[model samples]
Target: MRVLVCDDEPLARDRMRRMLERIPATLCVGEAENGQELLERVPSVYPDIILLDIRMPGMDGLQAASRLSESDSPPAIIFCTAYDEHAIAAFKVNAVDYLLKPVRQEDLEKALSKAGRVNKAQMLAVRRETGVAQPEQANAKEREYISVRSRKGIDLIAVADVRYFLADQKYVTVRHSQGETLLDETLKELETEFGDRFLRVHRNALVALSYIEALEHKGNQFYLRIQGVEERLAVSRRHASSVKKLLQSL
Candidate 1:
C-alpha cells in the first residue's frame, strides 16, 4: 500500500517517512509540506492512505481532508498531530486513526491496519468541530460546508462549488459545479448566513459573486453568466444596480 505524509515541519515528515519503512508492505510514495501541495500530489501519486498533520501554516489538516473526501475515491486519512484536543473530534469524523506526535512505530502500524476510506459525511463532521470559534479566537468563522441530500446520502458541498441559490416555492435549488441540489434552506436564511459570499441577483436568486463571470443584457433584460454553470440566471431590475456595483468592485 502506498502512503503519503503531509506536515509543515521537515522533522515530523522525516520521522513519519522513517517509520513508514518499518511498516510491512508499505511504500512511502511522497511527502508534502502544506495542504495545497498535498492536493496537487494526490492526483498523480494516488496514495492509498495519507498521514496528515492537524496543524499547519495555511490550510489545517481538517479543512484539507474535507476537500479530499469530496473526490470520487478519497484516500484513508490518519491525522497525525501534536494537539490532543482534536482527538475526540477526529473519531467523530470516522478517521482511520489520530496519532499524537511524536508518532510511534507501533501507533503508525496500528493506524494503517484499521485505515478505511473516509466519506464526505465524516468530513463535514470534522469541519464543524474544527470550525468552531472559541471566545478568545479572533476569527469567529461560519461553517464552510452546506449539507444537502444526494443519492449518496448527505453530501457536504464546499461553499465555493455553489454558483447560486434560486428559491422555487418551498425549496431552494442550489446550482453548483457538479449539478443542482434541492435544499430545505430559505433564500432569506441563506442570504443572511452567506451574505459575504453570495449576492442577490433577483428576488428568487442568490448568486455566488466568486463565480460571476459577466453580466449580460438580452432585449432590455439583464442576465448573469456564471463560471462553471451553463445556465445564465436572470438578473431582476431591482438587483441590477447592486450587481453592476459588484462587477465594478470585482
Candidate 2:
C-alpha cells in the first residue's frame, strides 16, 4: 500500500516514515509539512492512503480532506491527531479512522487493512456492467453513512446496517448489526429522510421494512418481531393497520 505522511513537525514525519518502512508491502511515497503541500504532491505521488494530522500552520487536515472528497478516486484518509475534540469534525469529512497520537503500530495496521477492503476497481467494474450510473453521478451520491456522536467518538453507520430506530427523550437509539448507538437526530427528521425504507410502527419508533420478521399479538397490544433481535417492539394502535397492510404487501 502506498501511504503519504502529512504533518507539520519534522520529527513526527520522520517517525511515520520509519514505521512505514517496517511494515511489509507498504511504501512511504512522500511527506508534506502542511495541507497545501500534501495536495500539491497527491496528484504526482498517487497515494492509496494518507496519514494526516489535524493541526497545521495553514490548510488544516479537515479542509484538505473536504477538498479531496470531491475527486472521483480520492485516497482513503486516516487522521492521526493528538486531540480527541476534533473526532466529530474528522469523521464528518469521511475519515476512514481517527487515531490519537502517538499512534500505535497495531492501530495503523488495522486502519490500513480496513481501508484496503474497499475495492474501487471492482466497484467501477460492477457499475459499468450494470449501467447503474456514471462515475461522477455515483460519487456525488456517496454520503450514505449516518454519523453518530458517542462518548468514544463519532461512529459512521451505513443506512443499510440499521434495523430500527427507537426514540427516547432527546436521543434516538439506532439498532444495527453491531448493536446500538445513540444518535442526536430526531425520529421525525429520520422519518422525513428515510421514509421509503423505514416504516412508522409507532409515534416513537421506526423499523426497517427489510428486517420485519412478523407482527405478534399478545393480549390487547400488538408487537413487532424483528428478524435478528429477540426483543419485540410494541406496535401502537394507530399504526397497527398500516403495519398489517405493509406486511401483506411484502
Off by over 4 Å in 2: 119-250
lDDT values, one for every candidate? 0.73, 0.77
Q: Candidate 1 lDDT, tens digit per residue, 1-250?
A: 4588999999988988988877654667789998888988876554668899988988788878888877544778899998999987766655688888888888888778777224223333332343311122223465687998878899887776688999999999988768878999898778767665566778898877545656788998999877667778998887686566444322
Candidate 1 similarity to native, TM-score: 0.46
Tell me the spans in candidate 1 whose CA falls farther than 4 Å from its real position. 116-250
- Candidate 2 colliding pairs: none
Q: What is the alpha-carbon lDDT of model 1 when measured against the actual structure?
A: 0.73
Return the top candidate by TM-score. 2
After aligning candidate 2 to the native by TM-score, how far in Å is the CA of 27 from where it should be? Answer: 0.6
**For candidate 2, what is the TM-score?**
0.50
Best by lDDT: 2
